[model samples]
Target chain A: MNPPTPRPQPIGRLAEATGLKVPTIRYYEQIGLLPSPPRSQGNRRLYPDSAIARLRFIRHARELGFEIESIRQLLDMADHPDQSCADADSIARRHLADIQSKIARLTALGEEVSQMIAGCRQSSVRQCRVIQVLADHGQCLGEHLAGSVKINEK
Target chain B: MNPPTPRPQPIGRLAEATGLKVPTIRYYEQIGLLPSPPRSQGNRRLYPDSAIARLRFIRHARELGFEIESIRQLLDMADHPDQSCADADSIARRHLADIQSKIARLTALGEEVSQMIAGCRQSSVRQCRVIQVLADHGQCLGEHLAGSVKINEK
Candidate 1:
């Protein structure tokens, strides 16, 4: 009978499986997001199949815009597979709301930017609509949008 | 008998007009983006109508997503009132291009995020499409989206 092929074990295999760099995996370990794996005879980190699955989970959550802290919470909740998914749903819902708010803000900014560009279509710097608008704070409808509302009186 | 209404100089007037707070205005000045104004009696900063115009221009440019460095370049070009409008047009056009690029990138991100959400519709974490997708980096199509690319790798 042919001998069974030996499987590659440890950090290299885990890195390849998860599409995460080795350093990043180490960093996640350092940050306490990922549990420490077992070591081989030479002290090289050895991760089982479960580690690959967890790393992939973390990567995907990140892609969907979940912050590191939020992912940590989600990971904790996910550990108890039999638990109600109400917490996961809530997290996802909150993320959706946040995305919606960002879209709204960026949309408003886009409109304002378009208008400013339009103003400069035909003028000289002396009469440049772009310059004129920037110089006159009153001309901005989105004064509050510039930053905070703390008005500084000199 | 005639009554006199006193006029405060440019710095004071700019602070009142822009709501930018004096220190912020000074910060802008220190950056060499804004030119030092002439001083009046008692060595107080004296600003002209042009200064107000400049301040407004800076504020508007900032709103439109022009960085301070770009704004400085534009201001320099604008200083020569008789210069051709071509330079100003180029600056505005470049800014517009930058905005368009950002919007395109964000739109791609939005699509990816939405899909991730759709995949997880009511599924348990063990069977969650969101988790599955995140765990598998190969499933993503946003390879060119720089910010998203760095999220899990680092």
Candidate 2:
């Protein structure tokens, strides 16, 4: 177990402790996802040890495919640990729905793209099935979105 | 179809033609993804008829989930229509593989989130299954990643 190295650490140390880049930590603060930590006498940002858990919570939420705005709401909900989690549940449900829809669209695209590649026999562009399929969406066999697939992967 | 208007239209018309935003057309030009079009005597951008095909191709490639860099390669290949499509095929195959991996990850996350939602009975945050599932990775039931799910929606 790491000895409690004298409470607060610099922003860089905080980043290192959380496996997050320095810029990302600052960006989180800038976006109000993370509260601004106190500053040292030399104008250096000093974050308390508690920041680690907060940052980790945000990071973990992001890894679970929650969008930034959804994470903000989740963070807010988590702040009031004793309140009802109905909002949290709703947010999770919405995120889950979005992920499912994206998966469905991607799965269909995967099949169509796979078929396009398989159909192509390393021929010239003139005879390239992949090119033809992309050039004309009507050639696709799947119902996957050829004109629109609303997804924001971040 | 209506008769073609006098040779060149403004950037707005170009955006309308391709269903791209005005700024996005500018961004494409800035990124060298789309070639700069000729300007009129008043310094307004004037795209020739060929620009429509070029922009549509870029948009279609994007809808197919090809990354910007892959789209660049595809565009370059399209420039030389007489060339073999081996590169295009490889790019499409690579993109297809990426999309497949992403779908797999999202599917796992979707299930976990759904379970968290299903297990919840609209309880308080203290006893909230969804919050517990997110806050503590060990609560996950499936082999899905609780600490990591690499995907972005946009």
Top candidate (TM-score): 2
For candidate 1, give the lDDT of residue B53.
Answer: 67
Best by DockQ: 2
Query: True contacts preserved, each candidate?
Result: 0.39, 0.66
Clashing pairs in 1: A56-B135, A60-B134, A134-B56, A134-B57, A135-B56, A135-B57, A136-B56, B10-B47
Q: CAPRI band of model 2?
A: medium
Whole-structure CA lDDT of model 2 = 0.80
- The regions of model 2 sitting more than 4 angstroms off are A1-18, A35-49, A142-154, B1-13, B142-154
Residues A36-133, model 2: lDDT tens digits:
99998899998987788788777667767788998888878777878999998999989888898888778877888898899998878877887777
TM-score for each prediction?
A: 0.67, 0.81
Q: Which residue runs does candidate 1 get wrong by more than 4 Å?
A: A1-23, A36-50, A118-124, A137-154, B1-17, B21-30, B34-56, B115-124, B136-154
Query: Best candidate per lDDT, number?
Result: 2
**Cα miss at B68, model 2 (Å)?**
1.8
Docking class of 1: acceptable
What residue pairs are clashing in model 2? A151-B153, A152-B153, A152-B154, A153-B152, A153-B153, A153-B154, A154-B152, A154-B153
